[model samples]
Target: MTETTAPAVGHQHDGPHGYASDKGAYLKRMRRIEGQVRGIARMIDEDVYCIDILTQVSAVTKALQAVSIGLVEDHLGHCVVDAARASEAEGAAKVKEAADAIGRLVRS
Candidate 1:
């Protein structure tokens, strides 16, 4: 099945089978970011202006962060919630794991 038909990784919401509704948007964002990354690479290869390259780098970084936030939100809304509904231990594990991942992201 395609992205649309696939069940949301962590949810059973009314939003197009979980993240399915968001999938299109996510892919579009990713593609835009991907192109930005390629442009940065090209700029570096061509020795483009330093400030211009830096600006592109910053944009790429922000785009990536946005994607990360979206995934984290989805995971919490769907996966963590499901685990919490399952059992306290599972919920605890999920929360701890998410926290650790967030910590890592923040440090990076």
Candidate 2:
């Protein structure tokens, strides 16, 4: 993969409503994750060894965690920052929402 960094909040990388610049990329990643999940289901249907199935499950979990981290980073760099620029109250709300999301992710 090419090495590139995310653009700052006010930069061109900001998409509509402060979403990530590469929304399509996120969708692609999710689709791949969905495929992995389907593969795991197939393994179970085929009566694969328990350990092998668990390994695939672990891979899927890690992929999902990576996606979650990327989304949270995008939210903080884009959405939360935009809200802060708009108004302090809006920013506070965004921060709380983000914290709640992180909390849920952690509990998961």
**Candidate 1: residue 6 lDDT (0-100):** 37
Top-scoring candidate (lDDT): 2
lDDT of 1 by residue, 5-102 (tens): 53435523333333555898999999999899999999999999999999999989988998888888887887778778978977887789889888
Q: What C-alpha lDDT, on a 0 to 100 scale, does residue 49 get in candidate 2?
A: 99
Q: Per-residue lDDT for 1-108 in model 2, tens only?
A: 432554433322334543458788888999999999999999999999999999999999999999899888888988889879988977887888889999999999
lDDT of 1 at 51: 99
**Using TM-score as the measure, which candidate wins?**
2
Q: How many clashes does the backbone of model 2 have?
A: 0
Residue 56 displacement (Å), model 1 = 0.8
Per-model TM values vs. the true structure = 0.79, 0.81
